[model samples]
Structure formats: structure tokens, C-alpha cells
Target chain A: SQQGEEDPQALSIQEGENATMNCSYKTSINNLQWYRQNSGRGLVHLILIRSNEREKHSGRLRVTLDTSKKSSSLLITASRAADTASYFCATDARETSYDKVIFGPGTSLSVIP
Target chain B: DARVTQTPRHKVTEMGQEVTMRCQPILGHNTVFWYRQTMMQGLELLAYFRNRAPLDDSGMPKDRFSAEMPDATLATLKIQPSEPRDSAVYFCASGLVRTGRTEAFFGQGTRLTVV
Candidate 1:
């Protein structure tokens, strides 16, 4: 069973425009991490936000976590065509031990140049 | 540069054939995870291991699927008789856990095709 569910199954944006994707999860999580996949091959870790931390940033990526609402959002600033990929929100379940990370259905982003 | 490595980037086999995939996690990282991705089912965690110990494999089909960490640096997933429905890209990731500081680094997945 997937704990995180991402909104906006697919999105199309022009180059340089900002893109935002949201994720809602059930139950408590130790941490929320965002990943990007290209060509349906491998995943690249973008950023991680702890349950205690509300927001985090890395380069053009920004992730915000709201445990109260059991949701999180990823914002891409000044998005480029290269930033286009499938984004997934993965939750490290608090109850499970040994790094039980569950991923949600990803949001596919297409950047038009 | 430390990164998880997976062998046999692609495999094509007939139905009922056995399939074996291997993974080598990054050095000093104690945690390993195996995941399967398909067109319909996004991503599913098949198994997880920490320090050569399997902590969870609830998502896997127990009858045909088996996962093991032969050593700290080696992890393997085997299917006795793979079916057409078992065709998918399998990924392996490793990480060092401590709250939010850990991030699992993944490898180029093994794309399996059962005909």
C-alpha cells in the first residue's frame, strides 16, 4: 500500500516557469524525501525534509512538509527543460524499522522550451 | 563518487524462466532497498535490509520471490519462475539512516521483459 499520494498526475510548463507538485500521505513519517526520474530508468534524490522541519531548499528545488495536514509540496524555481522528469514523494514510515520507504504515484512534468 | 550498482541492466526471458538480479550498495551504507516499477504500478518496495538483515519483505510474493543479502556489500533478488506480469524495472537503493539526514541513492534499474 502506498502512503504518499501526489496530486497533479501530469503537468506541462514552459521553460523558466515555476512548477509546484503536492503530496498527501497517511500516518506519521520520520522524513519526507523527493526524487526525480528520467526516462523511467533511475531515480535521483532531490531533497529531504524531516518531520520536525517545515521547509527545505536545494538549488532550484524547495520542499515543504506539513505533518499536521499529512501533506508536502515540492516547488521548482526557474524551471528549465532539463528539469522535466517524473517527481515522486517518498515517505520513511515512522512505525517501520530499517528504512521502510514508501513511494507514491509520481507526477510527470514536461517542460517546453 | 559512491553510488549503488545493479547488474544485468536488461533481461529478456520466456515465462516460467528463473531470473536473478544483483545489487551492490555503497560502501559503509548499512541499509538497502529493492523496488519494482511498472507502467501501471508506480513504485513498490519489494524488500529492505539493514546490516545484512532483512527487516521487511511484505510487499513481495513469498512463493516465488526471495531476497537476500549475502554480505554487507551484496544483495540479490531471485524469482523461481518469473511470469509475464513480473516484467518491470527493478531498482536498488542504499542509504545511511538517521532521521532526515539520510537519502537513498539508487542505481540504473534492471529492465526485465518476460515474453
Candidate 2:
């Protein structure tokens, strides 16, 4: 069973705009990581936010975690055509002794130039 | 420069034929995961290994699917008497679990087709 679920199944925006994707999980998590997948390519790790931390930023990507709500959000500032891809959130549940990462369905973002 | 490696970027097999997919996790990484992705079901976790020990494989179908890690570096997922429904992109990912927090690095994935 999938632990995380991404909202806004699909989104479209023009270049220079911002795109936001949200993910919600059922169980408590040790950390939540975001990944991006291009067409026909494997997923690439973007950023990881630990449960203790509330927010983190890397480059133009900003991630916010709200454990109380069991959710996390990924924000891309000044989106470009290259930013078009599927974004997924994976949760490392704290219920397990070992790290077991489960991925969500993902939110497809399309950036039009 | 280190990355997970998967063999046979593409495979085409007949129904009922046994198929095996191989993955070489990155050196020094102890966790390995196998996932199958299709348009309908999206990404489904098949199995995972931690420290070369089978951790959880309940997500996989026990009848035809089997996953194993012979050593720390190599992991394999095999399907006997493959069916058409089993055709999907299989991905192998490896990550180091440090203090219970780590991000995965994925291979290109094997595009399997069972006709």
C-alpha cells in the first residue's frame, strides 16, 4: 500500500510562474523526500526534509513539512520549461525498524514556455 | 559518479517464459528497492532489502515473483511463467540508511514486455 498521496493530479502553468505540489501520508514519518521523473527516465532525488525540520530550501526548490497535518508541499519558484515533469513525494515511515520508503501517485506539472 | 546499475535496458519475452532482471546497487549502500511502474497502477513496490537481508516483499505476488540478494552488491527479481500483466518498467534503486534518513538513487530501469 502507498503511504503518501500527492494532490493536484495535474497542473499546467506558464514559464516564470510558480508551481506547488502537495503530498499527504497516513502514518508518522521519519522524513519525506521529493523526486522528479522525466519522460522515460528514472526518478531523481530533489530534496529531503527530516521530521524535526519544518522547512528547507535548495536552489529554486522550497519544501515545507507539516507533521501535524501529515503533509508536505514542494514549491518551485520561477518555473521554466525544463521544470516540466512528474513530482513524487516518498515517505520513510517511522513505524518500521528499517527504512522503508513508499511513494505517492505523483503530481504531473507542465510548464509552457 | 557512483550509481545503481540495471541490465537489459529493454527485454521482450514470450508468455510463460521465465524472466530475470538484475541490479547492481551502488557500493557502500545497504538498502535496495525494486519497483514496477505502469500507466495504470503507477509505481508499485515489489520488494526491498536492507543490509543484504530481505526486509519486506509482501507487496509482490508470491506465486510468480521472487526477489533475492545473493550479496551486498547484487539483487535480482525473477518471474516464472511470466504473464502479460507483468510487463512494465522495472526500476532498481539504492540508498544508504543513515540515522533512518536517506534518499534513493535509481537506475534507468528495465522496460519489460511479455507478449
Q: Per-residue alpha-carbon lDDT of model 1 for B5-58, expressed as tens digits? A: 999999999999999999999999988999999989999999988888888899
- Candidate 2 lDDT by residue in tens digits, B2-82: 999999899999999999999999999989999999988888889989898889998899999999999988999999989
lDDT of 1 by residue, A1-113 (tens): 79999989999999999999999999899889999999856999988888999999898888999999999999998999998899999997787654588899999999999
Which parts of model 1 have CA positions greater than 4 angstroms off? B99-101
Best by DockQ: 2
Q: In model 1, what lDDT does residue A63 have?
A: 92
Candidate 2 residue lDDT tens string, A1-113:
78999999999999999999999999999999999999899999999999999999999999999999999999999999999999999998898887888999999999999
Residue B110 shift from truth in candidate 2, angstroms: 0.5
Q: What is the lDDT of candidate 1?
A: 0.92
